[model samples]
Target: MSSFDYNSSMIKAAFFDLDETLINAEHAHKAATEKAFAVFGYDYSEERKKSPNHISMGKRVYDNLKARRDGAGISEEQMPMDKLLDIREGYFLSFMKDEIVLLEGAREILEVMKRKHIITAIVSSGTKKYVELVMDIFKLRNDIHFIITGDDVERGKPDPECYLKAYDQALNELKDLHNQECIVFEDTESGITAGKKAGMRVVYIPTSTSVPPINYLPDYTIGSLLSFKTEVLI
Candidate 1:
């Protein structure tokens, strides 16, 4: 656990997870996966779809497709991961503009961070194109100082690489900011673990009850971003 004094130090920067945290895109993601599986003549199990694994919660679409293919005993020679990923991404991006909705208090929190002059970045397992599309559609480009996507990192959530990279970039861009001064807003256990491992405070906001039990504890758990107050971190 980090020894960050949340009560004393002002939050200098904020990092957010893209999909379920900032926007309600869970259903859209699932639909895209199912569509991709169908195209490849694979049966995406209902049980697997309903049961979200905490370990794979914040992983990339490619990783998820690989896992599914492996589980179904399919080989890359038959169904290439890159091809599967392309299909999945195509389905996801096609209707994501209409299917994605800003989560409650998402804009409010970003606005508060912006008004306070705090650096904000989106650290996501989504691809650069997907994340950029969401930002463009929601007009979040100006609000977000930077973004670190799956395309930008070798490892995804639960590995701390993405968040660490974001924090490192933030340190270079902003003065008087430490990793401990950054608060990560996340909706999945893997994201929380990644943030905590990066030595930052994490606020977990679970988007689904079906999500598996978290392996690591977060600094705070809130129902939604609506309850988040930048001034009163403690």
Candidate 2:
């Protein structure tokens, strides 16, 4: 983690990315994709997943599988996107009870934010169902003031649309809050880019699934949320 400091007192709102950022679900996602492919007598490899052609994370299961089909020369008629998504969702749900878990310091930070009366929201590209599931498992619904899911936005991350929407809502909730007074916590290149583009300070926390070699840098980078201290902001 860097020694960079934050003016926490000035930060009235906080936005967080889901998935690898809040919970350990990346591997479960990978496993679900692989299992879905196997059902159709296809294989998904690490090399292909790491390739530039791989679809970006945080996209709908349908979009990700569609990209995979396109790359594999499989037509939509041969392997329906909806069917693939259904299979993937089933596997993903099965893993949720055991494979997926809250990351270290996740609860502590949320508690700190709540205790300090800071507005907290989840700005994620995940669907409402999945996001709600995570909130239910971790019992975070009360801590989060609002949620902006992929369903709420026409565009996904790396595009500022989602974060911009969140910024607008945050501004509405807090009378004097500005974009700069909002901080975003992210674990992926796309998420970090979205936050910066939305004019919010970003805290980048790398995860196992985070794609590297990003063209841009975040305002702050930390190894994990465990290293984050809200006291500095006070």
Candidate 3:
């Protein structure tokens, strides 16, 4: 067997991805997407719902509407930006209300991290309102130290903006802590990439849908957050 070098540095702060990572709410997102698509008089099928490409389903629907507006032989008039916004908001609100559920071991892991005095935060591609709603519904509002949502940055996950913002928040909250001591917990490939690019160690926990295969491995990977023992931090 080959010997491997392990980094002995202890983590001081922890950032988590909100959707599908700490909360299993992709189904809510899918339901919202389907409802949004219906506003354009397009019905999404169960087959489309089951497709792996459903991760980009929202963007696809938006693009389709824009394409229709461009005409170029298509008869539909240009959809007002405000109308599109309404459709998106309506669908999200309809699906997210009382539908958010925390993943198994999520609350326990967060409690454990808090007990260890780790600064905990949420960094997500989701809108701040949505993230806040989920946190409130799941009773995690008082547990986390901060949240960096999509509206806080110009770009989303896989861009590093959100994670970097989250790190800044953590740094401010933990004034004496070094940036390298921060760790991120993610369930999606985009989130993991962003965390790593932000110079943070990442712990990946896969969800049932949308999470890409790990082409670039995270600092740690486990089936559940409960498997993350305190010894790993020490």
Off by over 4 Å in 1: 1-6, 46-52, 210-214
For model 2 the local lDDT of residue 88 reads 84
The residue-by-residue lDDT of candidate 1 on 1-234, one tens digit each, is 223334667778899998888998877888888888888776676535543465356787667667667766677887888888888888989879778999999999988888888889999999999899999999999899999999998877788999999988998878667888889988777788899999998887877642633577787777788877566442
Model 2 lDDT tens row, 49-137? 43354256655455556767776777778778889878888888887777788999899899999998888999988778888999998
Best by lDDT: 1
Sort by lDDT, best first: what order? 1, 2, 3
lDDT of 1 at 110: 88
- In terms of lDDT, model 3 sits at 0.69
Clashes of 2: 1
Model 3 lDDT tens row, 1-234: 111125557888888887767887667766775676567665554425333452442122344334333432323453464576568767776777666678888999888888888888988767777778888888887689988876787766677888788777777767777656888888767677788888888887776664554555687777787777566453
Which residue pairs does candidate 2 place in steric collision? Answer: 8-233
The candidate with the higher TM-score, 1 or 3, is 1
Candidate 2 displacement at residue 54 in angstroms: 6.5
Instruction: Output the worst ten-in-a-row residue range by lDDT, candidate 1.
Output: 46-55
Which 10-residue window of candidate 3 scores lowest in summed lDDT? 57-66
Between 2 and 3, whose lDDT is larger? 2
Evaluate model 1: give its lDDT.
0.81
